[model samples]
Target chain A: MTGGSELPIASNADVVLVRQQVRSAALEVGLSLVDQTKVVTAASELARNALVYGGGGMARVEIVENGPRKGLKLVFSDEGPGIADVEQALTDGWTTGGGLGLGLSGSRRLVDEFDLVSAPSKGTTVTVTKWAR
Target chain B: MERVPILKLGDILIISIQIDLEDQSVLALQEDLAEAVVAHSARGVIIDITAVEIVDSFIGRMLATIAAMSRMLDAQTVVVGMRPAVAITLVELGLSLGGVRTALNLEKGVALLDHVRGATP
Candidate 1:
């Protein structure tokens, strides 16, 4: 992993900002156009999830490398009511908030790696990565 | 904070989104489009998203909402000019956008609305 920037995810505008930043970072990492779009879209979903469900959080976007392959990594952490059931939460169309329930599952589909860590009263942290093909 | 502009043409209401939209702006665009449909008594709504680079679940839901809302308002809505990458990302994200109609470009979108409107009555 190399240099990256930390951004806030406390408002609606922050979500947009997160997407833009991720897009630039993805581009910098030499991801293809479709890969860049996927990562940016995933970042947007996770950032909004942090804001709406997690009651706001922080996003750390980084450029990562494994061997010669480069990728983009995003970590979103929020100090809100953490999710208890990770399995059920990752299920499609399952939402605690009135959303379409695609945020977690869909974001997982868009990226190469997905990790979720949270517990009751412990806050939530989601880390995702998408590598260039 | 920025509002997307909605233009009227004959019986069609056209909205070409040119900015990277925030959540609030997406909601505002939906509200504005609904109002424009009513005010103009438009029979068709063409939303040109050629410039939009991403269509995450939130924006995807907003598009579907606009389509459903326009239908109730007696207008047919068509989303146009989605980038190929955006489309792939949306599908992978598991958003089918079931009820929304899409076209290749603004002109085709207008034609689709015209065809639907003409065939209906």
Candidate 2:
């Protein structure tokens, strides 16, 4: 299994490049196109959130084997203002801005496993995983 | 992607969304939908999402926004043909697509729009 990391670019447009890199990495690690798309979408959302909400962050993509199955993991970390209310933030329809508030919650639903860690005035980290079927 | 025609049947304007309604695509269509509603003075708008496999929050919010905007223009909006998996995911994500009407199929959506327009007229 290979581990890779991408530094967050200050521009929102860089999120697309980051998404492509993560998708390519997922393919290199043997994920199917459908699975690759899902992982890529989740990564894109997180990366966009990092740029748009977190002020900027890095995304780390890693491949791991769990027994007989192999899976891809993406970790997005940012050093911006963390979520104040994690639960409310996860709730659908609740948004700090005019956004649809689907970024974190929707991305979580797209993956097999999702985890988030954030603190006020500190930073936030989001991890998402998808296993090959 | 094939561009589906904006079909008009009486007072209803049916626009088939042929791709994933996410990111900039959704944003672009918001203007188009508004224009369609105004140009035709449509009584109802049916947005077909059968080809879409995913519905992110951004798109969901756009749908809600479009629905609200359509209503303000005297047109009702109905979202149709959402896949079951996609529907479940949207629900799980807690996406509140409030104010947007939904139907299981395009035929049903058109029928519902007909009924809505009939009642209003």
Candidate 3:
């Protein structure tokens, strides 16, 4: 496993930058075109959520070699007012922000692994991984 | 702070997206597009995004919002030249974009928009 880079999520421009960076990382993992698109889209949604809802945050990209089954992992962390109920957050059609509410649940469905931890008024961290297939 | 130029031609507004669209830029474009539609008394709009290789859900929403807004103003919108990858990604991200009409290129999109208005130009 190799650690990747960190991207600041302070502004809208950073969102696009991180999306492209994640796409490049996913490409290095040799993800299929569809897989690359999925993870890239997922990255965009998560990064936007981190910036829009979390006030601001950071995104980390990592490359994993799990017994030769290579994959990429994305982590988004924010110090904003965290979600009180993660399960409720993951449910489609629910949003604390003025968005379409598909950012959370939709990203979950795009990748292979999903994990989230958050605390009210503290912060939220979302980790997702997509194995190359 | 990048600006999207909106050109008017015979009651039609055309926006050709040539740069990587930042969120702020897109939002600005949305606002400007709304204003242009009214200012020009445009009957239709055509957005050419052939240069955009990637589109997120937010961008997708922006497109849909533009289409919806144009429709509300009694003007039709046609999004043209969406790369295949972007379309695939949008579908996978669960955005049907049914509210907006799509065409393969700018010519087709203009034709469709003009057809809607019964305009020869």
Candidate 4:
């Protein structure tokens, strides 16, 4: 991680702040316009999930490098009640919160890499990365 | 909480979202638009998002919801000025925004509304 920042997700306003922070990081990492939008949008979803589902958490934005390639990595973690089934949670149109249920699944499609970890009582953390091409 | 202003232009209401919208702002915009449509007796609503940098699921749902609400109020909603990148991201995000009409820009959006309303009555 070269240039990194951490943002707290405690309210709807924080989610917007997360998006702005991620957008700047993506731009700094030289992501194209579309890629920048994808990553920022993903950050928005994950940040909101941390606030709404996780009952507030934190977001870490980092500029990562893989050899000559550079990328943006975002990690969102929360201490709220965790998901019992990761597969069902990742499945599209499956929501426990009456939302569109696309936050997890849709965000996965927007990035190059996705990792989700959670347990019924262990809380949840989602990390996603988008590489510049 | 930023309140998105709704401008009444004839029988149409124009809402240009120029800020990074929080969830509350999105919800408030929905309510404001609904009221504007009824109050103005609007036949069409144009939502301009040219300056918006991103449209996540929440914002996407808001657009769809506003369109649905406007329809029920006898007004057509046309979302215009979506950046190309935003459009691509929206499709990949699985938010097809079905039932919500779109145009390339505000001019086309206004033209579309005129055509739809003219053809209907």
- Cα lDDT tens digits, model 2, A56-121, are 888887887898888888889989899998988887557786776778877877789999999998
Pairs that collide in candidate 3 are none
Report model 4's chain A TM-score.
0.98
Model 3 chain B worst lDDT window (10 residues): B112-121
Give the CAPRI class of candidate 2: acceptable
Tens-place lDDT per residue, model 3, B47-103, is: 998988767777888999999999899889999998887787777667878889999
Q: Give the alpha carbon lDDT tens digit for every residue of A27-123 in model 4.
A: 8999999999999999999999999999999999999999999999999999999999999999999999989999999999999999999998788
Q: Please tell me the interface RMSD, in Å, for model 2.
A: 4.0
Q: In candidate 1 chain B, what residue range of length 10 has the lowest lDDT sum?
A: B109-118
What is the DockQ of the complex in model 2? 0.24
Candidate 4, B3-118: lDDT as tens digits: 99999999999999998899999999999888888888999999999999999999999999999999999999999999999999999999999999999999999999999988
Per-model TM-score on C-alpha atoms: 0.98, 0.74, 0.92, 0.99
CAPRI level of candidate 4: high
Give candidate 2's error at residue A46 in angstroms.
2.2
Best-to-worst order by lDDT is: 4, 1, 3, 2
User: What tens-digit string does per-residue lDDT give for candidate 2 at B33-99?
Assistant: 7888889888888888888655656667778988999999999899999877566666656665768
| Better-scoring candidate (DockQ), 1 or 2 | 1
Candidate 4, superposed: residue stretches over 4 Å from native = none
**Which prediction has more favorable DockQ, 3 or 4?**
4
Error of 1 at B53 (Å): 0.5
DockQ metric, candidate 1:
0.92
Model 4, residue A89: distance off in Å is 0.4
Off by over 4 Å in 1: none
State the C-alpha RMSD over the true interface residues for candidate 1, after superposing those residues: 0.6
lDDT of 3: 0.89
